[model samples]
Target: MNKELQKLLRQINDKKNEVKSLVNDGKLDKARAAKEELKALQEKFDLLFDLDEEEHEGIEDKVSRGTAKVIGGEKADKKNLVKSFVNIIKAGFLHVEPDEADVKVYKDALTSDATPNDEGQQGIGVTIPEDIRTDIIELRRSSDNLEQYVNVEGVTTKTGTRNIEVDAESTPFDNVDEAADFPEMDEPVFEPIEYKVKKKGGILKMTAELLEDTAANIMAYINKWIAKKTKATRNAMILKVLNTMTVGKEVVVSNLDSLKDIFNEQLDPAVAATSIVITNQSGFNFLDKLKDSDGNYILQKDPTLQTKGKLLFGEYPIVKLSKKTLKSKQILAEDGTTVTGYKHPVFCGDLKEAITLFDRNVLTIDINDKGSGMWEKDLTGIKVRDRFDVQPVDKGAVIKGEITEVVNG
Candidate 1:
């Protein structure tokens, strides 16, 4: 066959293999897309093959004038020619037998300008399908997603300010005598915090060939990757704010009285009632092993709900973070040896009142394959942008406590 016809046939075979692979893998959605592409390629190949045959009509007639026989000994017309070609291709894919007329036409087409293989065999190009699984494996995200603890405020503008009453609790109205002169009272002080949404994103470039040939949903995969990245970014930002907050009280994990003081004396009664303990794995390990004078574990399961897991002091909920997410610090011991210490932050109190996330609530995605550089390189660029800001709101509402090894100097 001519070079163009040969190239078209190769594409058709490749597409067929792709469809079979996707079906075996259980990726039905991608398999459907591949099947559609395969059908278009097959149609194009048929059209090109018909044109090629027409160009060699005289040679074809000479070769098939007597030997070629239709189903009913009828002359092979244009309709039969196309039908026979399609039937041969379908029979090859389905592993079934085609009509005698289709087999005769298929053999004639293969002999017309065909090249010999390495084994000196002609008309031998077939793809065998393989088994594939349907599900995709993905990385697990950090369980201590800090966004769930903090307050999220959606804003339309890029920059804005929020006013918080700083001393609302401290400044209270004084009782006035009946019809007597009112006592002078302190006015509530407000602190204005400014917030500007910061943009974070990245771009992924892929080859045009992979986009067309791959059985997986490339766009969906990219989108899922972006979502994961954005979640990690937000988690880091929230932790940064929480780590920098002023500590209301520091409690030594080994001292049971100090831990009790955190709730009774350090934090307000109302705040302590709705408090939670946030710590890393190492910190949780220490608390989990703590025992009362009775030799019973301090960190007991929630009495109200057994399925709610263990709680701190059987009162406050515990939000255990992974070591990677919470991070650790290097400290010098008294002997001048460096040691890794996980700063298990025990953030007790109302977390929502401590931090606020100003979210623009807009995630923009732009895809470009027509740009000059991209077109020349045959690459498609997928760009994503996420806008949000994390800031401390009521610092006093959350008290920070660190559980770490005693650094002897």
Candidate 2:
């Protein structure tokens, strides 16, 4: 309740509100900077709150008049000391150059000092900065279609791949003639569905001037760039594998009738509960106009799905891809004179049951401040790398349909 404590508490709350506002406005860099300031304020508020409580508690209340006076003065002195410490931290947040200790912490976080490799050469693990890691995570959440449907396995080693077995075909049942030679048993064959982890990343060169700027949120900027690079590379790899998988003759669609048939016939019936439909935006637009005898749109919204837009085709979730990644072919009517629309490959099935991702490592960063290339330019070179691969398994579980883009006659 003291004036000093009340003022500090108000400041802490105000700073917290400011940080929240920045985040809501999508000013992530500014939010990060404000969060640091708010942390300092909260630390100060905690000290003041505890000190005031202590001054009013048992020890101070039971003391004699003169003793009380001395103790109260001591409490005031302690409050002042705490305030001074807070001011020092605030000042450091403002204009102070990073001290030796701060630089050491930064270096330790970016470099690996563990034992060298087999040749006695030091290998860097390159710890990804938290801000960049966060950006990467958000990107994956929003843009990764493979992980949304694929079976992903994580491994600590630098190299590995996944293997899947092809399900054996069903045999025809025959009447038991009481002694008919046991029909020769068919051996199960294994399909080697393999994937190799690949390394993908980029480097950044920062000038000494930029590094020394006390007001810059360099870490945030670096993290954002790294996140973008990884997102692009990772998405491309996923799309490549999705496009490479073969589409069965029965599932290749040419019209709405055929598309519906794929859903009812080609999609593995067992995994229907978890199945999803995927197509490019153009293809989705075509489907959106489909109607039933009652003239109602067949593509309806389902609030229950986990997809971003919660779109649904029948009961299956629909993932409308704005990406221009899939291959397309034009379609014509049976007359051959009339163009119906384009046929874009539509994928429908449980991705987890049909595809696999081999993750060797997600992201790793290394810094070479003393490299000759940087010395001449007074810059530091930061190198980042990631490893992963994707492959399709159980082709029967991933049905590819040609989503026809019908032209209105």
Candidate 3:
């Protein structure tokens, strides 16, 4: 590389570091300005390089070519990326330089802009590959993750509004005489629900000794930790929205008739057809043991080949969460005394219509070795940030009820 190009590259790197610092301090405006300057420097470097227009050789393209050449004309796999990621993390923690291949992959995976979302800026770090992110998501889904049941919308901005029909099922088309003057119909009402993305994250502190382990082991540990934390955080937010919905009717744990009332009487036929039952472990136990007059279990195995699970009332799919995930609440008893109630909430309805999860689809990690006591303790703080929000849509679509008995205070 020419001296001029090398100088421009150094300038670009310095500008990137500046932008990252500004973003970390929540100075988005300044970070954006610095990013613009970095872009100009990059364009200047590109012009000086004088690459072929047909190839369109950008920095990432050059990095990929170099990586390919260094790896003996072989494509870099997930293992390579994983090792590179671990090396980058170690380099950040130890204040040392990473391997050439590691740096190449890291640069190749770099996002175009440091601050993708204006409202919530990501910290300084390497963005993991898409496959690794997919792995984390898959791990979350392996358990009782509530995201699978609700409607999830990927949003770019931090805040937005969604217009939903007032009553989609009731709004029917009017029939008029052919070629005749059409009668005026009532306008369908739409309610706009605004959603603002919230940042949820935590620091995963690791001992320096763990950095000596194999890259695959380090990757597995990190992926599992992130998946568990993100899943629990999202589940809590989703349940908070679910709790806001008014209960249409109370359900008796031993009474099958009362449980059936939610679907038969409380919910519309259209809604009942697509409704599902979500409850905690205690609630599931009660429903799972319930039998009809003929002594046949109400919850039957799903017969369809496409779906595999036990269906409640031979129709509605049932999802059971752990007690830790779905916590209990304290309620006032009839005697005017406080009681700890294990109100195992059993929610039944079309969850997709009831709630929407606006996912920013951005997960970032920043490593800090100089943070409080890190140098002395030889620990690295890995901060993970996930952006998303949960909001209620049609509150009437879902009905909430308790199955567990309350204890006296």
Best by TM-score: 3
Q: For residues 1-409, could you state the per-residue lDDT of candidate 3 as single tens digits?
A: 3335435655775577678657866799998999999899988876765553433344346567764334432446788878877887777675554454565565455443232222332223555656678889989984378998899997656687888989867877778888988888788899999999898999898887888899999989999999999999999998888876654454554479878888998877877899999888888888888999999999998787356578988889888888888875556667767576766788899989889999877777777766788779888889888889999998878888777665764
Across 48-113, the per-residue lDDT of candidate 1 in tens digits comes to 656755545644564487644444424355444444544443343233544445544543333111
Worst 10 residues of 2 by lDDT: 112-121
lDDT of 2 at 225: 72
Model 3 scores worst on lDDT over the 10 consecutive residues at 115-124
- Model 1 TM-score is 0.56
lDDT of 2 by residue, 93-174 (tens): 3334322222222322321111111232122323343333545667556533446567877544334444454554344455
lDDT of 2 at 366: 56
> In angstroms, how far off is 363's CA in candidate 1?
0.5
lDDT of 2 at 345: 63
Name the candidate that leads on lDDT.
3
Which regions of candidate 1 fall more than 4 Å away from where they truly are?
A: 1-143, 176-184, 204-220, 247-251, 303-308, 334-337, 340-343, 368-381, 406-409
User: Which pairs of residues collide in candidate 2?
Assistant: 126-365, 149-352, 253-402
Worst 10 residues of 1 by lDDT: 128-137
Overall lDDT per candidate, in order of appearance: 0.63, 0.57, 0.75
Residue pairs with backbone atoms closer than 3 Å in model 3 (clashes): none
